[model samples]
Target: MSSRLSSRRTRAGAVLSAALVLGSMLVGTALSTQASAAPAPDVGIAATTFADEFNGPAGTPVDGSKWNHEIGDNVNNHERQYSTNRTSNASLDGQGNLVITARRENPGNYNCWYGRCEYTSARLNTIGKFSQTYGRFETRLKMSHGQGMWPAFWMMGTTGGTWPNNGEIDIMENVGFEPNTVHGTIHGPGYSGSGGIGAAYTGPRFADGFHTFTLDWSPNLLIWYVDGQEYQRRTPADLGGRTWVFNDRPFFIILNLAVGGYWPGDPNASTPFPNNLTVDYVRVTNTPGGGGGGGGQITGLAGKCVDVAGASNANGTPVQIYDCNGSNAQRWTRSGNQLQALGKCLDAAGGGTANGTLVQLWDCNGSGAQQWAISGANDIVNIQANKCLDVTGNNSANGTRLQIWECTGGANQKWNAAV
Candidate 1:
């Protein structure tokens, strides 16, 4: 969600600034749109961690335990709406749906970024109520329509960090101007705002009926689906050396109907008021392996373990392959895109990208040099460098230091990450 305030208009041929605000921090807002219409892959279900069916009597507010109303005019998005906590803006339809209405009236006569508020809507989030790291999050909903209307189902990291750096997953976002297109995007460091990596699925008008939007998230993969059809996927490799922050932390869900922002522009004379964003349900289920936050031995060439030299937590300590003695240094933990042992991250020395750059243990500073992805080919890849974690010289010596080298599909590059 480009929930940032910006006066720069880009609806024509101009460019939107990359310094738009999301929450209280600045971020970019350009989406690299990829189009796809593939069928959704068969996915197995697991234990559900969260679910909201939106069941209640008509006109009643949502369950307070499940959602928090984020009130106030969102100046960050340069929106014309004042998000209210009243049930009049958000209520159950008695038929198993939560409706968020955006009206032209502002009963409070609230002031906005552009003087008087022109609209009133509702924004709800599950920040403290629930959060998950890696899972399949899905929602079935019907979007609001008309120029200037923006409806979204998205997630934001709970790291309490600045925008983009904490990461964001846009499961579904629709602007009324393009009734048949919905976007799925990921915003993070070096790739926020107008530079966000995303894709658009264009088909039937989303505001005409209900559709299921989904995000299947794992350690290094995120796939988007609309109504059981796959549209786009993202991985660390797609970030172009940027930090992949999605795997390291838990994220909470957000639902809102925004009115008139940089992306959707202002409402037109023909635009409809009191448009509704109706949601039937939202659910989250655990994916296999559960993505990040796992710990175990990372075994590799000659059946040796990836070990931190001397089990030291000191920064810049060489990381090497050692005999499988089951020592603390051999115990590796996956935290987001990082591999840690003895409280230090496995890092590409000095953020190096050239082959032969030594691998070492460093302070976890959320750098791309410390980010790694274990691929399906059993290759442990350095995300920033796009290189494989190779055992130096293909030697299995107890003290053979590891290095980042071009992926050669050799046994020296293969790894069995128990993390």
Candidate 2:
């Protein structure tokens, strides 16, 4: 979501329309509402890159070093709340939680798109303090609920580009009317605003208790999970040819409790005041072999290192396996989705998708051909070709050129990359 007037208003309208339709379909029906406790995070994914636990004295403001309070009326979403930096609007609960409260009174009589703001709330972001490209981002929180109430935990690209073009990933969003459901969405050029690609997860009322929301992002792929249960996955192929801008930049986190927005309309008489969106924690961890800007050797078949032939930066220079020599040619650095050695990407030759396509060094062009994913199984697969980086002819000899081939679970395709 953006801080200025943008396509999010359109996206909110779309969410409302869909909710209305679903509401009509379920008229007079009962939704099963239960309280669920947040699950423990998977023990295997223990590396932490960023985290905020919100532990502090009650009524204390958030750590300024970790979060920035965006104080203003959110005209972009046509929201009723005048967001403020006051502790009453957002504060630590002295119990390891950050509480963002939305109240009916606007002490400053803040003016909004609809004249005097009728409510007050808080919006916090990690824009300058932290940002990451590909990682496992997750939060544990309990939402606020009532008609016209909207709560979200999301991320926006950090490139300072325009909305949609910069990309937005909504890891968790809930409009009060849909008390038992939450949505995960992605917005980008050609498929943003109301046209965003997303999915919903229906479960016990989210406001009843804390739950875990997560997004696992990697080159050309995204997966969303609620309470550790996978619900949706998206890849470049799902975009129908639109640019997948997510893989090319880092994104920062946003958390807010909005009142009377386009999606939830206006708060009715039954809507409660002083409601809170309580966050237990927000954490981010690098996906193995996917962190950006660090150089390391990628060792593969017969313990040899992946190298650029002659340490050349020229495009089309062959990427080969050689004796384990600690040289720039053997040091690969991951930047976004592209793996680079000698300042050029490890690319599939000529954008080839066929078996035996020679792997070479090429300029980083933001093409799918330059994207790679080093899977948990140690197979470094080219995203565009869906093929594994292989040792040509299963040879571990010096100067053995690398190629893309069908993944055979063979030693030649397995790699131990320190990236």
The best candidate by TM-score is 2
Task: Write the residue-wise lDDT of candidate 1 on 59-132 in tens digits.
Answer: 99999898999877765667788888898899999877899999999788888768988889988998789899
TM-score to native of every candidate shown: 0.60, 0.61
For model 2, residues 1-419, the per-residue Cα lDDT tens digits are: 43222445422101000111111111111111212312211112235688787878999999999888887776667788888899999999987789999999978878987898889999888878999998878777989999999999999887847777888999999988999999999998888767889999998899997777778788888877675455788999999999898886999898889998667778999899989999987877777332322347899888999988897776667788898877777767554455766545688776767766777877554466777877788888887777778787777788877877777777787799887
TM-score, structure 1 vs. true: 0.60
How many clashing residue pairs, candidate 1? 14
* Model 2's TM-score against the true structure: 0.61
Instruction: Report the poorest 10 consecutive residues by lDDT, candidate 2.
Output: 13-22
